[model samples]
Target: MAGKELHVTDIFLAVQVEAIVAREGAIMAVEKGFSNYVIESDSLQIITALRTTTTDRSVIGLIVEDTKSLMARVTGEVTTHIRRTANIVADCLAQFGRNIGANLTWFEEPPNFIIHLLFEDCN
Candidate 1:
């Protein structure tokens, strides 16, 4: 899933938005029948929140809880925080999505635009 689209009435902090997106990504992975997966985010705060077992009563409490529930259902789920420089492909795709103002998902293979970045990331 890509692009920024939140059908909410109130303004959310950046960390909250990142948490929401992480939750959505987890949901998609589970729906696609992925039993093992690694979720990486540039937001260390969100990653830390997900790693914790305690209940979060903050503004993003519900989103974090739901994400944890999804993670529990997976067989081997890993969540980590990486610097944005280490995730150039995701960053580029996110920028592309924002430019187009639409949400997009690509399975099996990514779009042509980020192919080189993906290769570079792997190497």
Candidate 2:
């Protein structure tokens, strides 16, 4: 959902659960001076748009464009992942954003609550 309220370009990859990670997330993470991030629901839709080369552009086109722009400035390969279960961490972030009234910002990194609640048990 790339809009004035929440920009998809703000999201970045903090961790990779599987062999693949999202290109958009990877691009955002490595971007310079982008500290805070806000991820929205319907993440799969954004990823799908980026992966596909079809000209059937929708609202997701903004997301794909922002991702490509960010990727050019960032370093490293973008990873792609399968399975909803594998995306629990990002899923939780989306939930948090919804649970809150408006956008939530993190300074230089994701909040401690997220790290403790989600990434502490990384295996």
Candidate 3:
């Protein structure tokens, strides 16, 4: 298991940022040679955009399209919508990343700060 936290300098809308994050995550997964993976996001719009065949012409259309292209390269790829309430660990990590303003990756285990949240999430 691994987690990635990216800090972006440019500002974007919430949905756009979500799309960018999803795209980046997909890229990372492909780079790591993950044949099967799941992409979960609290943004329903992003999940819906990915699962659909229609083109998105909005501000995030390009990012969404690129994300879809990457998703095609992986076998058994699953994208799903998760409630923010159920995604505490991700939210905490995102905040932590923003606060430090750096890109971080953790392999095999999560950061100590979010360990408790992970346990709670499991429950």
Candidate 4:
């Protein structure tokens, strides 16, 4: 991790659970005291997932609800973006995910063994 705690700048809200997961993270941040945030992402799937309501009301629904509720509390507006270049921070975070390995330990810091994962097939 960096010496300074990073803030959620822009978020990429989409229909995909991955995007929702990021939104959920943003929501969690706001709950923790962040007054504003931006969601940046390039996935159309994730965007649609967030805007539509499906029958799949399992854990994902709970996440969506919790995220929505959290977003509702934010004084700032939730924004969206479609360009990959526009989402450097999120992409960086996703790259961080690549380092976490298969068994994702959300609460744990990413390990160095996973560094190679970032360079693999990276465009």
Candidate 5:
């Protein structure tokens, strides 16, 4: 069975940190020993950049670089782009983070309020 796991991080940034969340997911996969897995994101551009050798020079590029490097540390890793509608848990978690004003949060199990969403997604 897949052990329950959730990670959320927030930081005060002067600039936009759009792609960094994807990077954080990569970082989590490596740190948590996800040997064979597919990482999904709503952003196609971020997923494409991760699958290419092109250099990213943007402010969040360093984070993306770190993500790429971390992805390399594991085996059988795949990245895919998904629609936001299919990623409701992640979307809710992000909103939860913002609402709670938490700089960082990790949920070893599903959050209580999201139980219904999880059930709905099953169908």
Candidate 6:
């Protein structure tokens, strides 16, 4: 597992933060020599922008650009516009980030708190 604790003040929008997170995950995936992976996010806007592969001057646009660059360096498909209800595990992890402090964490196994949620997702 890999994640980051981002402060609210530095993030522009939910989609922007999501993009940043996706980019970070992709970079890690590349580092670990992953391929043909599926990157899922519940933010439709970010996903759509990513799929479009357009670069703009806005804050989120820069993030989108960065995300695309990272993804391009790796290999995978980005799954977007996932409904919140369909993404309970990711949702739970995002909530967990709130109290976890401001640091990036990487682990070899799933966080213990969300095992049930992951099971539920699989089922």
Instruction: Give lDDT: candidate 3, residue 90.
Output: 76
Count of clashes, each model: 0, 2, 0, 18, 0, 0
lDDT of 5 by residue, 1-123 (tens): 122233435645522243666666666777778776567888777787788888878666777788888888889888898998898787665655556644553545655656765666422
What are the lDDT scores of the predictions, listed in order? 0.75, 0.45, 0.84, 0.52, 0.65, 0.68
Ranking by lDDT: 3, 1, 6, 5, 4, 2
Instruction: List the pairs of residues colliding in candidate 1.
Output: none
Residues forming the 10-long window of minimal summed lDDT in candidate 3: 114-123
Please give, for residues 5-113, the per-residue lDDT of candidate 2 as tens digits.
Answer: 1223333352221102243443446543444333332345554554566642554455465555555454443424356777676666655554555644443465666
Of 3 and 5, the candidate ahead on TM-score is 3
**In model 6, which range of ten residues has the least summed lDDT?**
1-10
- By TM-score, how accurate is candidate 5? 0.71
In terms of lDDT, model 5 sits at: 0.65
List residue ranges in candidate 2 displaced over 4 A.
Answer: 1-45, 52-56, 107-110, 119-123
Which ranges in model 3 have alpha carbons more than 4 Å from their true place? Answer: 116-123
lDDT of 6 by residue, 30-69 (tens): 7777675466777777777778845756667776787677
Q: Give the per-residue lDDT of model 3 (tens digit) for 1-123.
A: 777888786765889888988898789889998887788899999999999999989899999999999999999799999999887777877766777877888767877756865666423
lDDT of 4 by residue, 1-123 (tens): 211123333444434446456566665556567566555457654544455556337445666555566666777745565787775554655655445444333323544433454555433
Query: Cα lDDT for residue 13, model 1?
Result: 88
lDDT of 4: 0.52
Q: Would you give me the overall lDDT of model 2?
A: 0.45
List runs of model 6 lying over 4 Å from the truth.
1-9, 102-108, 116-123
Per-residue accuracy of model 1 over 22-72 as CA lDDT, tens digit each: 888788778888878688899988899999999988889899999999988
